[model samples]
Target: MAKTIFITGASKGFGRIWAEAFLKRGDRVVATARNTETLKDLVKQYGSTVLALALDVNDRAQCFAAIKKAKEHFGTIDVVINNAGYGLFGSIEETSEKEARDQIETNVFGLLWVTQAALPVMRAQGHGHIVQISSVLGMVTLPVLGLYNASKWAVEGLSETLAAEVKDFGIKVSLVEPNGFSTDWAGPSSLHTQPLDAYNKVKSDFQAGLTDDIFGIPEATTDAILKLVDSANPPLRLFLGKMALPWVTQVYSDRLATWGEWKEVAEKAHGK
Candidate 1:
């Protein structure tokens, strides 16, 4: 059965690919970006099947308005992909409070608001899917990507809790944890790097390590997302790309080993 799908950040990157994939599979797509002009070509190509809306997920009013517009156009939104986000790369100490807060606003609160706006419609319909575009950083924290990791970690927790809350209503929540994908995500749109004299020695090495050349293609993530959307029973968390699998596995194993080593002290501190 063809369904109506609404995706955020569909101007480019994984979101764009996801929108196109769904369209190819005969689904109606309500794709949105802050600037709808970027999607003019997509609108021209797909015509009535693709409804392009201008939205900034960070704006609560716009979030609700966008959902309303999508629903008005498609009747119902079968899936909602929260893929509008960016990264902030800098040491925790070097990153200002404003930058950290903005990261949370865009990556965490933005999704929260959009999900909240969509929940009522899904509940009324008694069925829907919410897909969160998280990252491997959600599972493991790297040195300079603290704010980005924190935002994704919040999404992981939120998605888990939401899954339990909405499952009874036939609504499913999923997190897409993709490893570095070749997207403009790491380009000029990325948050400006904050430098501090105290960390100068290690900053260069860290900057080099964070470059985008190491990422794989964005299509890997889009493929995983399509599979999840089409599955009769999709996973709560879908890890994308060959790199994401091993990296996530290793992070979980290492965290488990470290936790086991500290279990005794941790339990005692918790009064267990």
Candidate 2:
């Protein structure tokens, strides 16, 4: 069935690609960005199938209004892709309070606001999909993307709780954790602080994807998004890239090791 899909951050990157793909398949897409003007070309190309709207995810009220507008236009939103977030590149110590707050606003609170606004409609409709555009960084931390990691980790936690809470209502939540993609997410779409020299040499080694070299470019992930939303029973967490599982598995393996090492201490917390 053709779906009424609402996508945030539709101006560029994964969001834009997914919007175009959905439109190509004859699905109705409510494409939103801070500047709707960027989508003029998309609307022209897709015709009436695309509804480009101005949306600043940091603004809670604007999120509700956009969802409301989508519901009014398409009757009900069958899918919502919360792809509106940017990376904050800096060490935790070097990151500014304002920068950290801004990251959380868009990556965490912004998603929450959109979900809150859309939940009522889904409950009424009895079925809907909430897709969160998180990152593998959500599961594993890196040197420079501390704030970004924190924001995505929060998304994972809240999204898991949301999935359980809404399952009874027939509403589903999916956390899509794609590794660094070839998207502008690390380029123009991202924000960064003046780097501390202490992090420069080491961070350069880990963040090769930040450069213009061949291995630095991210691969296309639009097909992964298609597969995710098309499934009737999608996973609560879906890793989109080949490297995603390897990276996440390492993190989990270390966690399990630490837990096993402290198993006796952990068991002491349980009632005798």
RMSD of each: 1.7, 2.1
**Residue range 1-272, candidate 2, lDDT tens digits:** 89999999988888888899899998999999999999999989989888998999888899999999999988989999999999988888788889989999989999999999999999999999999989888999877888899999999999999999999999999999887666777778889887788878777887664544322233266677788889999999998767778878988999999999999998998969
Give lDDT tens digits, candidate 1, residues 57-162. 9899999999999998889989999999998978888889899899999999999999999999999999999999999889877777889999999999999999
Clashing pairs in 1: none
Model 1 lDDT on a 0 to 1 scale = 0.89
For each candidate, the alpha-carbon lDDT, in order, equals 0.89, 0.88
Best by TM-score: 1
Q: For model 2, name the residue pairs that clash.
A: 182-218
Q: Give the TM-score of candidate 1.
A: 0.94
Backbone clashes in each candidate structure, one number apiece?
0, 1
